[model samples]
Target: MNGIFGYAATAPSPSREEAARVRDVMAARGPDGHGLWSSSDGRCVLAHRRLAILDLSDRALQPMRCRDGRYTIVFNGEIYNYPELRRAAVAAGHVFETTSDTEILLYLFARHGAEMLSHLRGMFAFAIWDDHARSLFLARDPFGIKPLFLADRHGTLRFASQVRALRAGQGIRDERDPAGVIGFMLLGSVPEPFTWYQDISALPAGHCMSVDASGVRQWRYTDLTAILSAAGGRRGDRHAALADARAAIRDSVKAHLLSDVPVGLFLSSGIDSAAVLGIAMEQAKHPIHAITLGFDDFAGTTNDEVPVARRIAEYYGAPHNVRRIDRAEFLEDLRAILTTMDQPSIDGINTWFVAKAARENGLKVALSGIGGDEMLGGYPSFVDVPRWVRRYGRLARLPGLGAGLARLMRTVVPWYIAAHPKAPGLLRHTSTIGGSYLVRRSLRLPDDLADVQDPAVVKAGLARLEIVARMNATLNPMPDTPQAAVSLLELSFYMRNQLLRDADWAGMQHSVEIRTPMIDIDLFTRLAPLIGGLPAGIGKQLLADAPNKVLPDWHRHRPKTGFSIPYAGWMAGIRDLDQRNGKAASSNGLLSRTWSNYVFQQYPAGA
Candidate 1:
């Protein structure tokens, strides 16, 4: 993993000192080396912080220039298919400098421009300067395994790999975005295209943007719905589809394993991680390393993941380490974890600890089974949302049915069930898949934000941030089946906003790279047609069956339990924080809503 930062200006040119300052903010992402480059006219600057995963040589240092000096690129993330891409480039009469993927990427873009993104098969966020056209091209990998943030200030477009880095060096006053504040409260993480800051924006996943004298333009290079749509009801035999899905998974894991350093697996009790370990062992040339995180609260209970994870690791002959985390250790690292947070999120607590453990073991990269649920029919959302729609379709469409019931439920329901803020508002989302998803995943209903924040702010934020509309926008080019629709929603919203982004910041907090092989666009494209109408009850069945029966019956057939922490109990111990009172208020009842707000206050925009 690395960090990229740069600015392209039309009138107000950037300076070398400013670029250096931006690069310095993310020095931890690339402790091995750093570089700064500027155009001859000083209108553009590119900076790179290199983690040195691919080629550990000075020749691989960037901001790398093309052989003819027509283009310069500052890149972040790994290009797993660089060897094949390099060979293709060479066959097309391209010359090479270093064996680094960064150079291959620059060369590929030099020849193919933005179209080169289609050929890429790894996680990346990069900016390429076309000196001849005085234009800059920026692209983020389809799944957003990497992050990119941009800001417009004084006629210059500044961008960075992280929001904090962009804020630290953009040289502008940051204002809190009311919509982003509400988005976080409603969804537990800020939605795409909006950051907590008013001026700065996160580049959406699966899209590219360009800045030139003509102005800025953005377009999607790929999207999950579009890819799934291409399936065109082409599902074949069930057995054959299962075989193809397994093959795709195997290929993806092998591809992600391409690295100069040791790659480890974040093994868990779930079938997703177990499947990944089993597949990696079959394809890998050497022994795989595995790490599992367990909590003291669930040491001997079914909730403990260490025992099962340890069994799978031993089955695969991987060197395993069960990182037992206790309440005292969590408290000790709570301050640092809060500080490492790039944005306020209630999730990522477990990720933060696991990444810390991985780094302590001297590993730089680890594979995670994050998108397995999204790709396969692994989440309860797959069934619950559709069922809600079926059961309450007509009533949900009544103008005031949801709002009226929400009020009644809040007044009468007990704290345990009522603490789930969205339960009463279920009817509001049942009319459409997008609306249903918002209610399904929401921490608090959008209409309830007024209870926590100012009425004016909540009103204005709700107007600006249309949660239902945003969800529907991802569904415009719809998938063929209800199951595919749920998968698309999960991948676009939950996996992108929470899981992938969390993995980036938390893993980088310890300088450990977290790779998700199941989330690759290529792999998704292959499995989409086969899994389109997959039954929600058969959670990850294709994956569980794909590993040549490596998974034991319990690992594959056990009840689905998520990797979780006792956040409510732990946060209660922190004296500085307001303890959760058993009330159905929007602000203090739920641990997620309270923690999200606390993190925001802990690290305010530009803090």
Candidate 2:
């Protein structure tokens, strides 16, 4: 993994020093080396900061040009299947100077053009400067596991692996995007295609863009929901489905282990991390290193993941390291955490510390169990969303009646139920899978966003965001079952927008590359046939049993307590510290809300 930045312009391009300054903004992401390349005509420039994972040789250094120099590329991700792709390139009469995946990527694009995206199998956000065509081709991974932000001003296009990196460059405007501001307020993270700044936007996952004299054009190449929806025709017996799922998990775990450096696992009490650890042990030639994050507050309580994670490591005979963090450490690191954050998010605190632990332990690459909940039926939304759609869906179809009933329930019900924020949206959201999911995952309901944001901004932002409509679009060619629908929603929205984005910024903040085997496109495609066919909850069990060893009964049956930090208690401590220092303390309600407000305050949209 690395930090990549460049510009393509109709006018004289940005200077090498300017490009280098933007690349250096993400210095933490790449500590190995740096390079800069500019077109002879001075219309395009590419710069890269290398972490040097796959090939540790200088030959693999990039802004790497093809043999004939028709293509020059700056890439910021790993391509897991590069070995196989390289063999094919060689067989087709291409020569390779380095064994790096970036070389293979350049060759594949030379041979296949945009079609090369479908052949890739890892996280990436890359820009290829086609010297022959005199255009720039930019593409992001299907899952958006890596980030690419773009800024277009007067036909000069600047792109980077980070939003802040783009902002650090000259000529990019800093005007706040109203939709982005409200999206962050409503979702705790800014949604895709919008950033905190109006002048920059994310390159949507599963899509590619080409910039040339005719201007820019973008088009989607893959859609996960559509893949799942079309998979209904391939259903098989439950036993066969389980077998397929096991094979897919093992294959994915094996593929994600593609690294030259010592790879580690982020083990937790949850089945997802534990399962990945088990499979890694079975497949690894060397004992895998397992890292777990433990909190001082939860050390002895059931919430602590240390003891259980340690036991799992022992069971696998892997090296184990538990890094214990306290409220004091959290407070001390607060400023740095917010500063390193690529954009405002409420979810990266845990990822931030764990990634730090991995880097401190001398690990450059680590595997995580991030997408397990969405891929398997692990989240409560899998059960609750479908149930809500069935029960209140009909009632929600009636416009005024549903809203009236919601108000009536609030007036007459018990205080706890009346005060519950989601209850008010029940009637409005239950009509469809997307609407129900918005209720399940939103940090604040649309009506409640007005409390924190200007009413006019709230109104205009909602109109521009069209959150519900976009969520619904992900369900196009809708899946056969509610379970599949919710899974698609969770994967496309929560995991894609928040979890994956957080992992990118947080992991890169510490110069560590965190890979997710559970989020593999190949694995998802292989198991697509079983997604709507298998009984609920069986997918996770299949994953747990993928390895040869049997997991302890306690782990399999343990309640799904998600990986969490004591943020509420930590924030309260901050408030107390502020009061003692004669400063105004931030008001508290929901911890998520408070943190969201705090992050926004630190990186105010207007600024």
Predicted structure with the largest lDDT when compared to the true one: 2
Compared with the true structure, model 2 gives a TM-score of: 0.95
- Residue range 1-607, candidate 2, lDDT tens digits: 1222233343555677778898898888889988888876677888888888998999988789999899999998889888888888888888889989999888889879999999999999998988867788999998899999988877778889888888777787767888899889888888998998889999999899998877889999988888898887778677787888898989999999998889998888999999999999988877789999999888788899988898889988889999989999998888888888888898998999999999999999999999998888889898899888888889987878877887677678846542476787788767888888888888788877877888988998999999988888888888998888888888888898899999999998899999999988899998888875656677778878988896778788787787999865687655423332222222223557667777887873333
Candidate 1 per-residue lDDT, tens place, 1-607, comes to: 1222234333566766777887787877888898988886577888888787788889999989888888988988988888898898888888887888988888778668899998999999998888888888999999888999888765678888887777767465667788888888899898888888888888888899988776789999986787788784778777777777788888899899888888888988999999999888887777778999988888788888988898888887889998988889988987877776887787898999899889889888899999998888888888888888888766788898866776777778857345466677675667888888888899888767777789887887888888888888888687777778888889888888899999999998788889999988789888977654776655487788667655777778898888888676677647556664412232454666667667766765336
Local error of candidate 1 at 388, Å? Answer: 0.4
Worst 10 residues of 1 by lDDT: 1-10
Off by over 4 Å in 2: 1-12, 407-418, 575-589, 604-607
TM-score of each: 0.95, 0.95
